[model samples]
Target: MAAPFLYSAWVAASMVLVPFAALTETRKLRRAGVSVARAHEKLGHATEPRPSAGPLVWFHAASVGESLSVLALIGRMGQALPQAHFLITSGTATSARLVASRLPPRTVHQFAPFDAPGPLNRFLNHWRPDAAIFVESEIWPQMLRRTHARGAKMALLNARLSARSIAGWQKRPKLARYLFEVFDLILTQNDQMAEAMVAMHAPPDRVARGINLKSMSDPLPVDEDALFEARAALSHRPVWIASSTHEGEEQTVLAAHHRLLKTHPDLHLILAPRHPERGDAVMRLIDTAGLSATRRTRGEHPGAQVYLADTMGELGTWYALGDIVFLGGSLRPIGGHNPFEVAQSGAIALSGPHVTNFDETYDAMVEAGAARIVKDSQDLAATVDSLLNDTDARDTARAAARSFTESQTDQLDTIAERLIKALELAP
Candidate 1:
């Protein structure tokens, strides 16, 4: 009854493929093509305590957004399973840094082993986790094969897959089935994601309990000194935040800022690009737009400073500094970023129609009238201007944002219970 070919094909594919990549990518560790997992081994989880006896659970998240969500989940899960140990792996330097600061006392932070067979084999042999939980859409062939082979139960939490992604996976049935078979459970974020998983042939019992729990991430800790410095320098300019912006979104923001300057000359724009590496490129974009911008790295807060929030793990503090918060990546084709923290920070939350990444959060906010959606460039500028200029409108939106942000009640506990059940742990 067991599917042996599926397992063999996945492992063989990884064994043949990953070595060529490891050799090439090891040369370029920090750049665009470099593997984040490789760089993390150099940075050290060398200090992490070796896993001891009962029910070692390993959770893997790909990048900043996914990692933060799982970090919160790990904390909740740890409280319920005091006897269990946890291995938390995230695939970005930013994510690793965030995990180091925020992970629970029982959790260990490491880079997830690459999808290649040899490394994955070594990883599983060493850590030997009894259960694995993957956040988001990580479906690496060898990692799943090795975990399943070693008799570790796997689950996907707060998971999502786009329609386009589903169609692509459907084309590769062998690979898709291999990935699907690995996860004992596939807990999705929304109905749309659930439907997509079914289309990709995820087994009936393996997928269920689809709900968007990512809206409940613990707010990133505020850097009090930096926030105080920024507040002191800005001298009461009506400020709007543009959080987690992608490429085209910045242009839209700059255009909107140009228009807003006509009505409120002292209005400041705070831009936080999605990628930290793109921070300098965004500063150049600001320069080219003829807007005075100041990078967060500079200690002196120059006059006419549209603060470029380039630092990591301070999104909460940045949101608090704003009179209006425009959740970026939505105004453009980029799938949008987490705006839940913006609402939590009590900033009047503004987003656009392209919020597929955080659709469940968007739905909750829109239904609660906690957030507003802008249709285009003009709409974005108008909404932000209205929020900034009208205290009543801003207060209404801020209250709604906070209300909806607070609505996600104990999702982590629910997820942890299901994960334990899937692992067949003693109740």
Candidate 2:
């Protein structure tokens, strides 16, 4: 019912790219994982498959945030189904690296097959998963249809549908109807998203939206020795961190840093880009801002300048190093990255006003006064400087951050239970 309409709108929904195969294939080959570029790469070569006939659960997380949101469930699933093989797929290169960084034992990571029919069919033929789970709002017409046809129990966990996305889905209602019908259970991020999915043709009675996974603590792992070394070198310098920044937002951090240094002479700032490939460009932007900063890829200390926390999977260390933190992509129009990650690490969380991507989480944080909102660059600098100088204020912010993040971290658990029932598995 929902298949062909979605299949046709793959283009209209801006879902499929006509030139992606040609553009991405060569880039995937040319780029190396350790390099500054290729940060968005999600999967590796699916050229060969090792056959497995056991009960295999397939978890699909669209990118870095969506991918991380499923971690708790993945860990719990492993405990519940220790005998079952687990296969997880994330859609971006950075996500692949992050998943590879800390996935629990027994889980294997793969790049999601492109939405094209041929690759998806090939993947289905080989993996033969017993269950398929979607972390968020990833709808592939062919993938859903064929996976159901393969006798796999399909569920959407921690799903969300915003007003903006709803409008677009309505534009292609025929396609959306097909996509919506394919799921046996749709576990949403919030009540609003669940209501929206209902309007979009998801099974109303089966729809459950309650747990918000982004509010979970950051699984950012830090090396104790490395932490000691960085801290020893940093030495009482008031610190702040900017994690997962987008374009045009770098200058804001730099501008804030310049103002912050005036009052707190030893104020140190760290920049962790959303894309690792853009490390050099961010370094250049920092340099152009007339601030002396060192790239972490080099062994240089922050030293009265900024430190580019340009390395991947090291947000744990950076978050630990900073007292005040800003989760970027919010200050600009880019749907802000996860604020929950920093909050769990005990950093004071702040953002710019444009956090439409995680509005519910952001609003909750604001209502709790766990996060500070900076509407523009000037407010950004002022807010950061104030947080840095005032210990009580910083502590208040970090407390708010932890409270909001801790409160919303259990969606994965709820989804896990529903998934078991949907699969008709024994309790």
Candidate 3:
């Protein structure tokens, strides 16, 4: 099929705007202290040379969560295809830093090129990826079309779409089909998403239900020294973490912590906000809630009523300190953050009612007695108290959580094999 008119128009507009986009994005990255050469990657200027002999498999994800989710898959694929070189691309410097620490064997990381002819051409020509795998919701039409044009097999893995996105695509059915048809396979997060893809005109045979890649994400790396120091500072104080809390959710977390403090006066709440930049605002909230707090960025010990874990990349240590955890972002319809980390840390997860992002995972967890749903401050407080007091119940929940996370790992090899065959990545 010929390219849709909308897609062609988009390409034309992008040709004019790409230079400005590259300049602006590179400038932002540079100001964030990225090296000039690395920042220019936004323009498809790769810092590393592509390997000369091996088949190159490219994985592209949007940011930190998406980027990290694919590492285990890459590891599995690398084991299967020992000679294949892997390239993983994303747009954020933060993701680059994190991924650098956990990159799979024979894998290289780069900032993805802007989806314009000049950058994409430069990128495609240099790498010449044999196969391209795009992660959840990263459907840049130009990128897909250009990659397909290059004769590379492509797969859309861990695909997810909001209802609003489906409605928008439904309006441009031809363009939707045109883009969806580029992928050799489309593995969705759930059956509903598979149906959504089909409704948007993706070939029915190409779309299939797949596990949530985020649920299968590699366990967060823990800092042993930090964990030990934190444990000593807390000195057996009852602890529960309210992790990845957002703006509206913190007030409720604080209220619940306040109620818990009345009974378990020595209870410690490590409040790790989703964005570390929100530390100051969260500190003010802690003050208003009449809770004594200490900031992690300030290097304070976790002795206060609330330990403000408002720094990036330290959630693993926090998760280790608590047996009971209330994952935030579910309370106010923000969808929930990953519960996999909580389960991996061997903690019982308590989440609010709205966890659409991880709905399938959360549902299975609740049904298996691995997680509980709390509605508000009162509910959250009661659940935490019960878990803290009841060792048998807490242990059982933790066991269930471990069991669930372990079971998910068994599917990784199967998924990896499927992708290997679908994208023709195997030797």
Candidate 4:
């Protein structure tokens, strides 16, 4: 089918803005100290060479969560197609950093090109990917149309769209259908999303419900040396983690910790904010709460009532020290972080009710006794206190968490096989 007029208009607009977008993105990367050549990747300049042989499968995601969610799937696919090469692209420095450490074997990471004809053409021509998989809601109209035109098989994985987004697409049915038809398959995060995609005019035959890719992510890498050091510093004090805490939510968590301290005097709280750059601000909050705290980046021990784990890439180690974890983001209508990591670490997840992002995963966990929902500080404190004091209950919850995580892994194989078949990726 020919490109719709709206699609053509979008491409024309993007083409006109290409130079400005490239200059802006490159400058941002340079300000962050990225090398000139690497920073120019936004202009479709690749820092790495394409694989010489074997089918190259490309995966593109928007940012950190979306980027990391597909690593395990790549690993599974790698095992199935040992001779295949994989490439993943995202637009954030943080995602690039994290992905660098956990990249699957035979996989390469790249900064995605700006979505315009010039950049897209350079990217697609250089990589020459046999298949493309787009994660979450990263729908670049030009990228989709261009890649599909090149005859690469495409699938939209872990797809999701908000009600408002669906309504917007419904308004432009021709362009929506044209874009959605570029994908050979559309695997949504749930049936509701599948229905929404179809309502937005994605072919019903191509859309199906799939597992939440975030929930099936590879377990966070644990630093054993740091884990040992933290364990020694704590001397087995009763501990709980409040990880990925956002701005407004910390007050509630601090209040909960204060209440818990009255009962368990030696209890420790590991507070890891979502943005580690907010370390100083978080410390001020801790001081105002009248709680003595130690900072992780300062190399201080967890001897104080609160351990400010204000660093990136150490969450697995913190989760190892506790059986109870209060996942943040949920407490303040921020959609919540992944609880699969908590489950992988053999801990029960606790959160406030606002976990719409991972609603299906949380619902299953709550049903299986692997997770709990708290309303506020009182509820959080009471839940933590009970779990800490009741060994049998904590043990059951931990076991349930492990069981839930294990159960999710089986579906990974199914999803991988489906993608392989749909994308014709088998060697």
Candidate 5:
């Protein structure tokens, strides 16, 4: 009964939202630098024909991080179910590029359609996926309902429900229950999130505590030639990296670097902005600080005190050049970026207190002594100084991080088997 009302309400809301969403997409395409010509893909228009053979499993992620988190699982599942072909969809242009560059064989990438009746139906008709899997907190009512109507087995993987969102949903319990009930299974990131799912009326049996999948993801890919050049140019300088930094955080990072420079004059800082499109703005910021900086986009070596690695898809290369890494996005209330990538790069991870976005993973890593937290520039500089000065502590943290990462491997196997079994049982 609630399902009918919820569906009707969603239909009405989507009808009203379609035009606004289209305008928003145009703005995002402009800012994010995706092609305007390919913008039709977001309206449920297919750029490539659906594969003619094999059962298709559709995975939808909202952006780069979510897409990367599930990538290994998809590969493992594809290997186990060789007859299955994977269709991965994301809404962001950046994510689409990463998917195209790194996607495995028997898999394809597409931009997801907007959540309106026309677009959702067109996407469903063309792809006809046997199973639909959505990552994290992306809940689209039209997409969920339309996919369910088409008889696709739906699963929510590595799901997270923030406290604020939970509070909002509690006020609309029937609507929440109706929407969550659409998922055949709900694999949550932690016990807190699992409890939230049950509280919101997702069947307790259907919802299970799952490990954070980012801990098991492969390291971001690197370009070998660039890596070699960067390493050779450094010539064993005392180095640290501030990776995936947002707007306000870079100022703090520069201040921290300035302090560190007073003691070690040749200390090199690799500053990687979260969005490479902010490269020009970052250059101006460095100039304002009177720091000598070189942009990686220009294919320059690190001859200055600071290296502005403002390029895409080369985090692995930068990670290899430094041992002390400050994971960004945490310092500026942007939640936090993943730290496991730094761990995989064999660096000691340092982060700020605002890691609620990756709460479970960060907490586990901290408890295991694999990561350290910083409150401000002074704290960050001190932590980096301590780690770089003590080889034993640094190596121990590095080893603990890799061990923590290794301990989570079996969870993916369990998850893959369960998903494959569920897909097999689906009509």
Candidate 6:
């Protein structure tokens, strides 16, 4: 039987509940340090000047990772369609900060408006984007409906659908069809995702198999002075990064580091928690491990056994310094953060077994000899030990990673070309 609370009912309820929802979300944003003056942007009022008299394409991403994944795509699309201006919108303060710092010329970043009818209408009317591209799985019902009504061509780029989400949408078949069919094109990260979208009744012709855009992301920028200082402080010690670690995963990383230290006493760890705000708690974990540490957010250099990289936007710097990268989130049930980002950094990437989130990407890398998987802390330490001692094997893994990542660049060009055709066909 279909779910009792169908999409129509949810839409009706949303039409009435939007005000309370907006207020609650606005409060959270304020607490997260979003500027009060510019908060109106989230309410569908523009604080920045809109680009005029061109084929303006609007790209929407949920947060920092998604926002950054599209940077290279936007740059490619900008070059391919020189007449087009780009508007990038994300829903977080951190994403806004990153976008502002990294966005290309002639591109604008705005906090995405809430999916309420009022704000979305206000946003659409003011900007009147010719085409809209949404990153990953952000299929906001009201936003999708409003954008479709406004005659903007739409595409779901690097689309992913988990088994749970597919099951939920299957409960509302018509609603699923309505949402999926609205997009002029749907580009998926893998054949598995493409097949899932087809099962949800997304048009087969419109669904194109493609790679994860995160694989094609521009290398994270590094602060040269910071890298220099980090090198000087470490003085050529062996290093590895626990990149994008979550709550329970930090303890695992700490345990692995503790074990690795006993064998390779000069080994260093850069623990970058997934959420920088968790820095304090992570520091406490490090202390419990009886390890000396430095917190990067406090402006300390990495001269200790563990460096807690509690700051944001510096993954590239650490990646450049690390000999191996063990991606976090996989250690816990949070799936996994992007390993391609690690591979793109030219580091030998390793992860735990629970990486269902990027299953295809990870499987491909492992098959290509670009990544390795560890089942537990002992395995992690053992693998890291082997990699560190075997210089030739380590170089082979890093080279394989770079080669696989570079080979996928042409996929971006294919996506950009298809997107341009979609834009031309827009009403």
Highest-lDDT candidate? 4
What ranking of all candidate models by TM-score puts the best one first? 4, 3, 6, 5, 1, 2
Better of 1 and 6 by TM-score: 6
Q: For candidate 4, write residues 1-427 as lDDT tens digits.
A: 7789988988889988998888898888777667888777787888899999899999999999999999999999999999899999999888888999999999999999998989999898899999999998999999999999999999999998777888999999999989999999999999889999999999999999998999999989889999888899889699999999999888899999999999999999999999998999999999999999999899887889999999888898899898899999987778998988899999999999999899999999999999999999999999999998899999999999999999998899999999999999886
TM-score of decoy 2: 0.87
**lDDT (0-100) at residue 225 of candidate 5?**
87
The 10 consecutive residues of candidate 3 with the worst lDDT sum are 37-46
lDDT computed for candidate 2: 0.74
Considering TM-score, which of the candidate structures 2 and 3 is the better prediction for this target?
Answer: 3
* Residues 134-222, model 6: lDDT tens digits: 99999998788779888999999999877899988877777888788779999998888999999888888899887788778888898
Candidate-wise lDDT, in order? 0.75, 0.74, 0.92, 0.93, 0.86, 0.87
Candidate 3: which stretches are off by over 4 Å? none
Using TM-score as the measure, name the better of candidate 1 and candidate 5.
5
- Range of the 10 consecutive residues with the lowest summed lDDT in candidate 4: 31-40
Q: Candidate 6: where is the Cα deviation over 4 Å?
A: 1-11, 425-427
Q: Give lDDT tens digits, candidate 2, residues 1-427.
A: 5246437666344335524763664476346443323222222235335435457888988888888777777787767766776778876667777787778757787777666555666678778888899877787666787788899888887787667888888777667767777788887877778888888777787788656666653467887877887788888877788888988889988888887778877888888897777988998998899998877788766655788877778888888888678888887677787777777787777898888767777787778877778887688888887776677977787787777656654655565666777875533
Runs off by more than 4 Å, candidate 4: none
Candidate 5 C-alpha lDDT tens digits along 143-260: 8878988999989998986788888877777778777877888988888899998988787778988777777787778889888887788888888999999999899999899989
TM-score of each: 0.90, 0.87, 0.98, 0.98, 0.94, 0.95
Looking at model 5, the pairs that clash are none
Q: What's the TM for model 4? A: 0.98
Against the correct fold, how does model 3 do in TM-score?
Answer: 0.98
* Model 2 regions lying over 4 Å from their true place: 1-23, 33-54, 161-165, 409-411
